[model samples]
Target: MLNETKDPLPVAERVVGVRLESPLVGAADLIKAQEGRASKAFAMRELPFRDLVNVRGELSDPAFVAAFAGVVGCEPPAAPNTVARSDHYDVLWLGPDEWLVRSLAPVQTGMLEAKLTAVLGDAYAAAVDIGSGNTVVEIEGTRARDVLSRGCPLDLHPRLFKPGQCAQSVYFKASIVLIPTGDDHFEIVVRRSFADYFCRIMVDAAASVAP
Candidate 1:
């Protein structure tokens, strides 16, 4: 049917915005939100069966470096982004004198820690399990960098933070180790005692961003 045609003014589409489920949402929902929306979310989850091994030997010792390389199966003088990984373990260079060895499985962590401590005898180094003292917070989504920048002083631009990067820094007025899990995700390692406080600060900060 032919009607008087008047060009209708363009109407802006009223797109529906997603409502955040809740901070108490399930893991499945959390994963879904991260995949769908470009929202940053942090979950303070209990990470079981992990270990932190620190090498205490002098950095200048050639024999020590060779022995470490033998066990780690990688060069001691590591270049940037140099990470040695076994099936269940990963060795990350923290500095010229320090490095962090971590593992997911308890047996794997125990075996590796014992092996390294034994291999690198009293004269070589020490390996202590400090896993009990820390808490792990998994953060994900596109806004992850901005959420972290509120508390951290480091430049988190992707160009500076490549994958597998970890650094010790001030997080919400507490010291923590920030590990990049992906391009838009990170795992924040904080002390166990300060976990509750850390979570509270993160919750408040996230609310502002999410709103």
Candidate 2:
């Protein structure tokens, strides 16, 4: 007689109907408090719930590159401090062998990471969903650069740091991935742990530069 056996893998849990909060839950209130103190030429807001995946692999490996391209719809940026973008995602070069994949829109958590991991199977690579660990903050308008320059040490001159470029730098005490989205617009990807402090410091900086 043969005995019945249960499946070894456990079933994935489905969570639903839960309310979600962004890392900077109080950002709106903080911005409102600044009111006229903050510059009219500057604005700051959190782009919460974005999907972020940290991918690591050798770009020289054709198989690894192909696998990533097949899943992400574009080859990872080969140039240092550049970004490779597609309709759905933007791949930012973090290091010689590391890239941060950010979704243009909100996606089911871990969906992209799972697809990447599945396709990159047995290839020297790794895909980790870091969405929950980070949040995006957008600072724009005429005085945006001034606010950033107050604490960030990078050269904010347009001739030097143009669009489609990114760099890992520190904003005051918080480490951030800075991306120039337009002439006067920049996005900062910072850790959830530092979101509050980042907003407070940024607000203070904006107020300092107010006209």
Candidate 3:
């Protein structure tokens, strides 16, 4: 007689009607295991599975700005290349009519889209989820600037790139969005396709100094 066997994997769990299982990692993880960390100089890690959305709307429109501030839980930046920061989210100004909204908490993409759409009725705007298409890498430590300057030409001096500043710059060959969150601390947003290449570049740059 044959006996039935049970599955080894744990059943998927859910919270608030959302699936909370099927764990995943970011593109950088593929090389994270093999790379020699520059911890002595700079520490690096991928901030995967974040709530990142592309926002395009007219800031001149009061209704549009109001709708955006409502959902993001913070007001949008009026100046160019600046970030409106809060404990839960950050609104990054990319252009006169474009912005990138990154939420600290993981959220439902569809639900967030729906909420924004509903609030922006008759307003010319769009909220597109790019979480699956890109990821963020945080690098910070004593020698962070040296590692970044290896490929990036931006003047990342503390006097020039203090907290609350963001810019579009190139790293190696990848065009990335750079945000300085604190002294020697930065967040880089890169396309999923270029993530692997950039990770390798980061490892090489970090190797120059020491761990």
Cα lDDT over the full model 3: 0.77
C-alpha lDDT (0 to 100) for residue 131 of candidate 1:
56
Worst ten-residue run, lDDT, model 1?
A: 14-23
Off by over 4 Å in 2: 1-14, 32-40
- List, residue by residue over 121-150, the lDDT tens digit for candidate 3: 989998887776777888888888888999
**TM-score versus the correct structure, for each prediction:** 0.68, 0.89, 0.82
Local accuracy of candidate 1 as per-residue lDDT tens digits, 47-131: 5446666665656777776676677665443543345666656666667666766664544234556667777764566666655
The residue pairs in collision within model 2 are none
Order the candidates by TM-score, highest first — what do you get? 2, 3, 1
lDDT (C-alpha, whole model) for all candidates: 0.62, 0.87, 0.77
In angstroms, the error of model 1 at 134 is 1.6
Off by over 4 Å in 3: 1-31, 34-38
